[model samples]
Target: MPTQGLEKSYSREHIARQVQRLGEEISRDYAGEELLVVCVLKGAFLFFADLVRAISLPVNVDFVRVASYGPHTQTTGLVEFRKDLEMSVTGRHVLIIDDILDSGFTLEALYQKLAGRKPESLKTCVLLDKRQARQTAFEADYVGISFDSGFVVGYGLDYQESFRSLADIYLFDPAQSV
Candidate 1:
């Protein structure tokens, strides 16, 4: 790990405060509607856990695993569903939670797929948005941080399935590429 490639981007406290704000926003907006918290698995596990708990209202939680990045840092723009949601999202306010929105492929594809299900409402929530890495067209409905695009890892983001244990987000050095 090259210390030079690393940059302190989001601290744990900063991330938490933003999450709290996001929760409050949701609390106010969907005051009466029943909510479904859909956690995109793997990367979103940590963020999802924190977010659902921070929320003040009752929420139905479910985990769905999807894959677009396979053995690569860059996305192929193909989204695949490895696991589907176990709960019914037929007619409820659903929130799609994700860790980072790097390329538009995953989220956009998901939105399209879920849209066909006819949910009462569908919205997105991302912890970090690499607003620059987008190639296709997609945007997060609620974003915690708008960060410069970079190979960032930590919090819930990982590199080669490593560094998921770091409490804060750190940048990745391109020089470390194999």
Candidate 2:
């Protein structure tokens, strides 16, 4: 695998701290309300697990699998719904958790689909936001980190289905490695 250009971006400790803070904020904002925590599958599996454990509020968990990138560094701009939620979001406070906000197409598509179901309120949370790569105007309600560029892997994020188990985030440049 081309792991030569991998460079550490966010340490595991740093990610844990940020996730804890985000959880506290979420728990405070939704004080007395129950949350339908939806995890965008595959990439968000790890972040979703940690985030839900951090929040103190009552949470119901569900999973949806969507794909825009298939073993590629850039998005294909077409969001494919691989798996649908098993529970209904009608009149419920729904929060979508994703690994990263890059081109925004995948998140936006998912958001719109859920919105059509008439949730009482809908929000988004992403572990990382790459503002410069946005092809749509979608913005996450909660964001852990923001950066302008570079492909990142690890801590639930992956490149070609690899590096997701790494303890920290890393900048990976495929062109510079073999």
Candidate 3:
């Protein structure tokens, strides 16, 4: 695997600190309100778990599996729901948690679909925002960090469904990729 030469980017402490900050921000913003955290599954699971723990407020959690990219490097541009949320978001404060915001198509499609469900309020949060790769009109309400376009793995992000168990994030060397 090209990841044999995986170069560490973000450290575990850095991630924890940012996650705490995001939790505090989210907790303050949603004070005294019923919070429903929608985890954009597979990738955001680890981040979602840590984030919710940092939040002091009571919040419900749900998972939704939406995919725009398969095993390839680029997005297919076609979003599909592999798994849908079981709970009704109606009248609830909804926060969608995603691992990364790349092209914005998946997030935009999800926002529109969730908006149609009549949630009292809907917001988006992302662990990493690659602003340069955006191909659609969208923005994250809360962002943990931002970086230039690069393949990252660890702390919930993955490359071909591996390297997710690493303690910190690593930038994959494209030149090393086969």
Candidate 4:
């Protein structure tokens, strides 16, 4: 592990089960419709791949890169769109996937931007939901897990762009930061 005092919160099996359940739910809800899955890049890439594979329907995938957190533990509060979706989502069922929902600022901003594109319906799916850190009035339509608060890394999440490759999700103990 890159960081000491880290504790495993969610095992790889647990995450797989959750992803399967979510995929089933999505497939059931949008059985007759085509899905355009938009993945928030870098962090959500791993989760996005697994999730799309789980879905029973054929899905079109696109990636958008946004940054609100820099080389620190907290959000910078300024969201920057490093990249945008390549395909148009208009008149399509669009699903936005992210690794985590932290302060909601980044997701909220992205939602508004995509919503303005006039997708037939837009929904958000997040692997981790840190509700305690939410600063905006935005919520994911499909959430895998809801955690209180911690700097978590694994399964596509990172710490200063590290630890994302871990199979299990681990919580970074702030007291151990040096």
Ranking by lDDT: 2, 4, 3, 1
- Candidate 4 wrong stretches, greater than 4 Å: 1-4, 174-178
Cα TM-score per model = 0.93, 0.96, 0.95, 0.96
Superposed on all Cα atoms, model 3 deviates from the true structure by an RMSD in Å of: 1.6
Q: For model 1, what is the error of residue 144's alpha carbon versus the real structure, in angstroms, after optimal superposition?
A: 0.2
Tens-place lDDT per residue, model 1, 1-178, is 3334568788899989998999998888889778999999789888888888888898999888888888678887778999998888889899999998988889888888888999999999999999789887799898888887788888888877876777788887657655
User: Top TM-score: which candidate number?
Assistant: 2
Query: How well is each residue in 1-178 modelled by candidate 4, as lDDT tens digits?
Result: 5546679999999999999999999999999888999999899998999999999997999999999998877898999999999999999999999999989999999999999999999999999999899998899999999999988988989877778889899988656767
Residue-pair clashes per prediction, in order, are 0, 0, 0, 0
Q: By the TM-score metric, which is better: model 2 or model 4?
A: 2
Say which prediction, candidate 3 or candidate 4, comes out ahead on lDDT.
4
Model number with the top lDDT? 2
Look at candidate 4 and tell me the lDDT of residue 99. Answer: 94
**Greater-lDDT candidate between 1 and 3:** 3
